[model samples]
Target chain A: MAHTIANKQKITARVRRIVGQLNGIERAIESEVSCSAVLQQVAAARGALGGLFEELLEDHLRQHVAGAHLSDADRQAGAEELLALIRRYAR
Target chain B: MAHTIANKQKITARVRRIVGQLNGIERAIESEVSCSAVLQQVAAARGALGGLFEELLEDHLRQHVAGAHLSDADRQAGAEELLALIRRYAR
Candidate 1:
């Protein structure tokens, strides 16, 4: 719906960039980059991936769980899901 | 620390149940709840305030711009501020 139109392109671009980053990480590992340098890239890629998840989660809440046809239970469930996600990824 | 002990008590109990659903929608429009049931509780309190701004922008992008120590232009400017907040709150 409206949300999809607003975010589809940006999300697609992010995913594409993340894929490239992952490939680059593989190359780094294969070439035996210094441990610290390789770890830095790994951390950066993780951040990008987390950004993707965050964007999608926000869109889902704004369009489906939180803003659309749903019961109070659904809202609570969505909130719980969000909490769980934050716990899992941010830790 | 540690994602604020895993999401700060479920986002403070969803902002205290959305402030009791905005004081029950201002007492259901000052006690004259008739216009389509007060517009369906004002569209369910605007979907629980868009699920508390989508769980605080997904815990600030899984803890500060996609997993911390950000670069890559702050992860694409935090994905263009989440596509301009899903195009201003899903239209």
Candidate 2:
């Protein structure tokens, strides 16, 4: 959808930060950082990625699957489409 | 982390909805939903999965990578852990 297409840059920026963090973690591992410390960073990166995921889902709901302007038939169709995606991703 | 462990139910609910959406999409395909309509649902599903990813990332960041109570050494270690996760996910 246009919303995602338009917001690609925004999403990329966030993704880049996560990437940077990842690189840092690799260095820490190489240097033999403490286990607890390393685990903490891992958790942070996980959260950041999750945030990005949530953003995409919300956009999908708003713009594609749950478009406010779609007719009932269109909406039903959209629901089915989203359902398929969920099945694919969940597995 | 404890936070993610705590919020598992909340996250699962959202996930279930997305799954339901996916099932619908499969049915649509079985019945030969139009390409345009199917495509729209596909976009929606993509967005939903992305959202789920984001949610996990956020939890990781807040409870693990960027924990408020960590020491500098511990925090550094956490960063490394998060970085590893990012690299893994990105690839």
Q: What TM-score against the true fold does each predicted structure earn?
A: 0.42, 0.45
Across B9-78, the per-residue lDDT of candidate 2 in tens digits comes to 4644654565555455555545555434444554565466555555656665676668788778766765
Can you tell me which runs of candidate 2 are displaced by over 4 Å? A1-91, B1-4, B71-74
Q: What is the TM-score of chain B in candidate 2?
A: 0.76
DockQ of 1: 0.02
Worst 10 residues of 1 chain A by lDDT: A61-70
Name the TM-score of candidate 2: 0.45
Task: RMSD for all candidates, in order, please.
Answer: 19.9, 12.6
